[model samples]
Target: MIDRKKIALLICERLLMEQEMLRVNYINTRDSIGFFYIDNLLPVAIATAIAESFPTSSEMKLKKSLKEDKYISAQMDKHSEILEEVLYAFQDPQVVNLIAEICELQDIYPDEKLYAGGLSLMEKNQFLSPHLDNSHDKERQRWRVLNLLYYVTPEWKIEYGGNLEVWPNGLKAPQVTIESKFNRLAVMATHNDSLHSVSKVLVDKNRCCVSNYYFSDEPLKSSDTFHVTSFRGWPQEKIKDLVLRTDNFLRQTLRKFFKKGIVENPHYYKKE
Candidate 1:
């Protein structure tokens, strides 16, 4: 069972009460990177249940590459009942609309198919390089607008790493660190220049999060342009950075000329 009633009750009680305040704060600080987080997003008991139910890193698919080491899976049927319920709770239409109001976006819709939105598990040494998400869905119809991240790992701390870093002024300036605090929810706009990444995890334990993205008919910025999921290494990784830059340019060029590309992206859930 999805247990949406329970999820809805908690969200309505905890998050809906602060919608207007969050809207003002989100608008006031949205010019660059544009994000805000709410701690203790759900009751501690529910959050603990979700965290305890998360599949181990070994159970999820290891997306090992230069960009990240996290385990990600969109196949909800394969996970525990509570995991699916909590993941989709963010997808609830009312919840989606409320978040849209907070982020000041219109006609935004949650991705029920879970394309690039699902469970994420990171363990020791896992990290995600700074990068801009793909500007659109797998089919390029709707513009990917907002990234909704709900961290559920219990007792997670700032020092544990895996914190989200946003580069509002590009990579040269110091980044803003948003700790992946347990039971916290982060909403950040995703567009042409929303460069962000997760710092490497230092502890041996696993960090888990439920992620979802909202899409719209129009791009966030009128000047937004289409692009592939671009990546760059840490500031000190001079050579890797250069290589990734070249790689990004090539991918962008390919995407511009070939819209959907020769082969489809394999990241989406292939429901049977």
Candidate 2:
């Protein structure tokens, strides 16, 4: 059995070793959407174990819509113990604090409930449209400050297309593609302008990832405002963009009246 404590220790070590480089990368990109990535985040053997242990897509909950087509689950108990262990490893204090230090962020806290954070798998034809993450936690308390994505799909290629896309300059400009390489961990700032998405999977194999988010008592920027997870179509998809814009507006308006949306978002973990 993989111990989360041991895994977290390894994560902390890696982050410490790469702290300087990570800080520089983040500083370079801080003007647009601050972000950085580290390769070989865990030992190859452990990463492979996690990849092999991922549940089949059919076993996870399918979320298919205009915004995305993927499998996600926060019900950690329903999956392999290692999967749960690895997910929470990012939440470990040492690991979280190291990441916060590298990003120059303060007052950051990990989400224990795993709200909108857990395992995600995308198969061929599956994709997530460009969007900004929800501004706050489920309860409207802490500001969602950072997104942590740890990719474990061994040998996953750039050509296979399940990569993380960041529209730093918005949809009008060319976007940057970060390969979903195995054993690689990518962290990005989440703010009103930090629009990002996942490229559609072109291969038939599953592209799996473990995800987590760190929240802070204050927003990343003083001017940032609260908003729901907003989605938009590609630059060329004019009609779809219009429809999604309307959808975003409606959802934002709904949140104005209801603290939580009409129907609860069933994406978070429910401890039993």
Candidate 3:
């Protein structure tokens, strides 16, 4: 069993401590992305144990098109018992309450479907392109509002790559990249403007982190116009960007009629 209360207190302490750290807010009114740096988020002992449990894989499987780039999704239902416990620790009422308090979210709930959850591992040359997440939940009953990413790569340095990048002003400008520090959690609002991606894992080591998305009845913003989760490429990946944009157009267009996009995004849990 996970001690949700202790984890929540720890998170609150970190948030208060980080009030003085560098805070990055979305540049334009376009994106709702924000970054708060948390140091030593998970206890050293717990982080080390979790790191040891990470499977040593030469390569990742099941590449899914997110935005214009490809990613490895974590299937919550299939996770090991320990991993599931650690992941659920983030969903505790206290932890959720702290996140809501820090990000100022209203009526937040854990999406058991986990639209996109699990460990995202990127090795040398592997990269994720900038893109917005789908705006609605799996069933389209609730709206996707926040993205929660917790990094547990111990002793990982900036040179290792796998930094979190936020392109608040669309693809034309330089993106703000934040190091995926160990035992740190990055929570940001996900709206039509929340354009984000993971930089290519530059070093030989694998960059791994746990992820979860939260949903609510209310959208992130009242005036946040309805649009599909859009994606764009780096200034160099022109061809890839064009293809991805077209793909997004088709999905969003279908969403207008289907409400749940063209095909159901099975990023979450499925019934047996």
Candidate 4:
């Protein structure tokens, strides 16, 4: 019972209101980035319940650069019922219709497979280095067009970092940071140039989120080349970026041979 219909409607209404708040002059990039403060974004009880469904021991080990909370996807086939609810929210006909109408999206289809879209939680000192998401979907059949992130952490504070940072500029420059507030949804265009990441959480708090990516039959940019999700260290962390670049290069090369890369990232939740 995710109450997807109600949630979708609420989301639509919030977006309509916030649509006016989108400052074209302030957009961090040449492309688009919109944020909506959706009141009652999701049922608090349901979110807490869903978050508790998985045991602490079941949480996935995060990428090693920093401390993190957990990573869980809706249980693969087994949690289809719960998964469907989340997907329905992401694929709500009205949500899709509004996005298509507003963004002028060209051919928005319901993606049945969630890919790397799922839940992420980060705790104190946890940091996700600056990075660019993979330019294409797993099969490379669809262009990764949009990134939808819904934050659910209750009473999250500014000092307790874990904000989403988008670097429309190349990795060499400063980035634009968007705080991940509770009951808020962030939607942004995803192209090869869409560089983004999560800032480190300063305090001992958990930052949890729900994520989804929408893909199109065509590439987001005609000139967009195929690239892996590239990561960079802080501007001062030059050595870290060098190491990460090598890591990205190897992974990208492997992707050329293995369509899904060395091992399929088990980002989606799976049931026992």
Question: Pick by TM-score: which candidate is best?
Answer: 2
Among all windows of 10 consecutive residues in model 2, the one with the lowest summed lDDT is: 98-107
Q: Report the C-alpha lDDT of model 3 over 1-272, residue by residue, as the tens digit.
A: 33445655666666666643423232222244665556687678877777676654433344545442234555544544455566666777766766766665568987765666766676677777787887777676777877888887888887787888887677788887778888877776788778888887877877778777888898877866566667777778899888888987887778779876656665665537
Question: lDDT, candidate 4, residue 180?
Answer: 84
Clash statistics: count for each candidate: 0, 0, 2, 4
TM-score of model number 3: 0.85
lDDT of 2 by residue, 62-121 (tens): 999988999999999999999999999999999988889888987799999999999999
Cα lDDT of model 4 by residue, 182-249, tens digit = 76667777777777778888987678777888888887677788888887677888887788888888
Candidate 3 weakest ten by summed lDDT:
22-31
lDDT of 4 at 163: 92
RMSD of every candidate to native, in Å, equals: 1.4, 0.6, 3.2, 3.5
TM-score of each: 0.96, 0.99, 0.85, 0.82
The sequence of per-residue lDDT tens digits that candidate 1 reaches over residues 1-272 is 43966796677567777877888878876787788888888889888889888988767888988877889988888889898888778888878878887787779988878888899999999999999998998778999999999999888999999999999898888999999999999999999889999999999988888998989999999989888889999888889899999999988888777889767876666878
Clashing pairs in 2: none
lDDT measured at residue 119 in model 4 versus the true structure, 0 to 100: 62
lDDT of 1 at 18: 84
TM-score for model 4?
0.82
| lDDT score of residue 79 within candidate 4 | 42
Which portions of model 1 show Cα errors greater than 4 Å? none
Q: What TM-score, to 2 decimals, does candidate 2 have?
A: 0.99
